[model samples]
Target: RPRPITPPCDLRLQSQEVQVNLGSGDGARRSMMGDSSTLLSYYHEDAKTMYEVFQRGLHITGERDGPFLGSRLPNQPYKWLSYREVSLQLAEHLGSGLLSQGCQPSPDQFIGVFAQNRPEWIISELACYTYSMVVVPLYDTLGPDAIRYIINTAEISTVICDKAQKAAVLLENVQRGDTPGLKMIILMDAFDTQLLEEAQKCSVHIRALRDPPGPDDLSIVCFTSGTTGNPKGVMLTHGNVVADFAGFLKVTDKVIFPNQDDVLISFLPLAHMFERLIEAVVICHGGRIGFFQGDIRLLPDDMKALRPTIFPVVPRLLNRMYDKVRA
Candidate 1:
């Protein structure tokens, strides 16, 4: 069950000086203007890598006890995977499973993730980071032409999709030779022997990467929505994402306190930076994240079941919810 929300402390900006130590033993200090009006002003020394942030959370949460990711079935109660369970699955199952099958991604290679907000998506992202592969997130709402353009632009040979339907679209492109470089389509839901056989005939291997990615290496290539024209790819490194997490903590620590017991409901697409950054923050703070069922109609029921402590929402969703309440 989620804890009741507590009133947030008043947040205001003032002026002072404070020392920031970067976890180094040396008394090296960097002075920065502090907020004199609010006692909640705090900053986390920047982490060198996204992996370090994850490691910090695992250490803090002790891995085995609490829920890290939660989801639901058609009529069953929410299912949970603990931090330890998730980590072991990533390291032993998914990572090695891909590698053994010859799915090795080159350093900083672009791999596509076409899926909804599920635990598999999170595992896949982490697996890519572990192998130093750059992830290209594909929005589920994107049309076929747009998807083809991004895949070609990124030169993605292998993609991980949540369902056979999504994979079928990519598979069709592969067969037509439109996406010549595309070699494999990994479906998260169920194994399709026919697809595997077809991929094999096309000489594409279904696999994972051999080497782990470093902090400074490229982590994601996020494509902007092609509202006016074709989407543009934004390259982000592990350091860049870690910096964002640090910045978020520095600013919101006072008003938003997160801990092991915190529960966050995720409905926004993970392809968007806002949701992705919030996911990283929740993981860093040792909180649980629950994904809403893909249908918007089920959001209300899902929310009631999950009982999320923190709701990170966009203005559109907020406006709709407000209208519903007023009615």
Candidate 2:
């Protein structure tokens, strides 16, 4: 027999009279059946830019000795990146290196990100933001034709890819003269001598931008999954992202309060809005993020190993977990 559920003594039905003022001048009031205790609110000043939010997060929590981001290592423990190390890498290595390489994309120009959820992916994203380049995320599961469509539609000149297979596809397109405007392809992983030599021989001049992008400028162009037809692009500004972060904080401050001690296990694709938003929120709160191994079948083991406090997931994943539990 199944165990019966118990009700708490505090559960009760009560009616309370609440008065709501229409405005300051009108002096009108309306009666509502609710108590003040039922209401919750949170307030915060809006940030001027997304970069400003990041800067504030760094200012508040960068001094802590705890790791800010981590990834699982093969047959070993997780490798971690401290807040200070992340900042240094963004400033000294990824950001500066891109600039030195002359990867100066124009305002509103799309820079493609073709990779899985990794530290390099985050670095590339932040580096693009630092120079005001618009990002176009390309999912790893997308085929060559879909990839070609996005590249052409967004007029992506430069692309940052993680694996050799993706790079080969892009190289094939470039060689076949399919992507006329394509200039450079940056591989996050180490590349062979032949690939590097071939890339150098291309006409694309890999250079950095001269000026920083403004808050109102378009930051990213997210594409829909295109279950119906062709994928469509949705442009969002830096201010839009900043406002969203601020709004989310205002709404969920009481329910989901993240702290330095909290650990967030990242499994969703960074290209998804939910994951990206949560990542920004976690960083703002100085929480640690640990990435799962890139296989869904390993999620249970990863969860066990990471022991995360917060798990943000989609309905499909949640349903699967529930089914597994029931089974």
Candidate 3:
């Protein structure tokens, strides 16, 4: 007989893998759960057409209220803004500057997002849509080679990343000829006089991006984990992600109701599709997104401050949470 399964266990969970259900088919065929499906009905109509699920959703207000995740931390307090406020700001930013001058954004133009998790990531993505430029997100855990591959593959020119991740970009590969298209690298963590000086020295331009990226344009590029050979870059166009977005909304709606000011704590790597989709949902709903002070080790303390309403995680991470709760 096989050994009996024990009730008390000491199984340790790794943090690399995240688990989520991806729906079948492309943009037109995909069925998303949660708020995604409801949002998709209006955005994605054709059954066979590949389309981007942009624009979080038509703005709506709910009666319930609470402290959103990013409302206040440290010296801050909980303040809420409706979905309309956030998405409109995204639209306004996209319409500014060189972005609005063209029918289709130049291929030489590219935007990179290198943050951990926060409103900046979503805002940056939305701005890319307005300008019709492609948004490339970097994995925090990726080595310099992987990072270089993404940059080179996409021919990325402008980049927006966290201050903590700047060193990686400045390392041997990036410093060498590995990255050719990289021009601007903006640090999201820049807060004080030092950040301003860094910006001046690096000649980094810090401002909101404008113009809603066309629905048919490629919105984001996600690279798969190179489990076999070189990692395959999964090109998720706006439609591809939007389909998943709708499917996610369909499933999510049956379980919980979301509001624009709802608090969300994001712990997954933003490069992953699930996290990116979740970020999109958060943007559509108009909620506050809180960046953790550090890694998973510091999330508990951060959680106390953020008090997230919706939390997404891989099975391993969830198992760890269960273990901690039991302890």
Candidate 4:
């Protein structure tokens, strides 16, 4: 005799068991979402793509002027960047600004994002998605040679960079005639006039301003050094990332993240999948995210100031923190 499967409200979704036969029978295509197959199909869902992730929040909150999240430097109070559910948001404006500058929308068109974790980085990424363009993140680990290789390989015409020192690195490549396709470098923070002057000499346009809401979708391309060859790119479409978010929530939502008034200190490199995945989950749950002060030495100060409700760290950092405390 069969009885009821109780606990109606406390369901904890578990990952499907791994199977040996991937392409046989009702195989790998079989999923918890009975009808869904490719993760990229996440695009066809309610949000459509990452471009809509923030705007969806705006609709839910129904707020017009308040900021979507927070980010700031040391000694300064946290700052907010208003993200109304507008045809009126900064992301759209950035996309339009690029369009006005003749950077047209195309699935193949790529933009390089070289910045630390900040509210601006997310906004710039959303802007890329809105414009039907892709993001190729250039991180510190990639260095100059690889940065040049990626720019030429991706044919990136514009970049959104964080600091003048970083912009100077990209400009060095430009001066060497390595990243010829590169045309503009948008600054996320204030810089000395020297950067602008240097930019002019390299035939690059540099500007520091608020930018965005464009609609549509794009993808991401990350690079890794090949074992025996040069750097190689691995592209993840909109579906790839959002699907990760959906899967994470189903498994952890009820147990670990039941509370919605969540806050996170975002110190991880957004260029990596793990941190971005953390962000996706947080955003889905209406969580607040704050960045660390750029200096690792000031991380404790940033944490104290941000007073986060959530902290995500790797084993390496955990061990370092433990050792520091013990010492």
Ranking by lDDT: 1, 4, 2, 3
- Distance from true position, residue 171, model 4, in Å? 2.1
- lDDT, model 2, position 143: 66
Please write out the lDDT profile of model 2 over residues 147-237, one tens digit for every residue: 8888999998888888766776787787788887788777777667666556666564432221456668887788886777778888878
Q: What clash count goes with each model?
A: 4, 8, 36, 11
> lDDT winner among the candidates?
1
Ranking by TM-score: 1, 4, 2, 3
Q: What TM-score do all the candidates reach, one by one?
A: 0.82, 0.79, 0.68, 0.80
Query: Candidate 1's residue-wise lDDT over 235-296, tens digit each?
Result: 98877787666666665566566788888899988998888887888887788999998888
Which candidate model has the greater lDDT, 2 or 3? 2
CA lDDT, every prediction?
0.74, 0.70, 0.56, 0.72
Q: Which is the winner by TM-score between candidate 1 and candidate 3?
A: 1
> Lowest summed lDDT over 10 consecutive residues: which window, candidate 3?
46-55
lDDT of 3 by residue, 193-309 (tens): 644454444544343232334445576677776788666777666666766665655554645546665767777777788876676666556465676654678787777877787
List of clashing residue pairs for candidate 1: 98-208, 103-207, 103-208, 132-213
lDDT of 3 at 252: 49
Candidate 3 wrongly placed segments (more than 4 Å):
1-58, 61-91, 94-108, 164-168, 171-175, 191-211
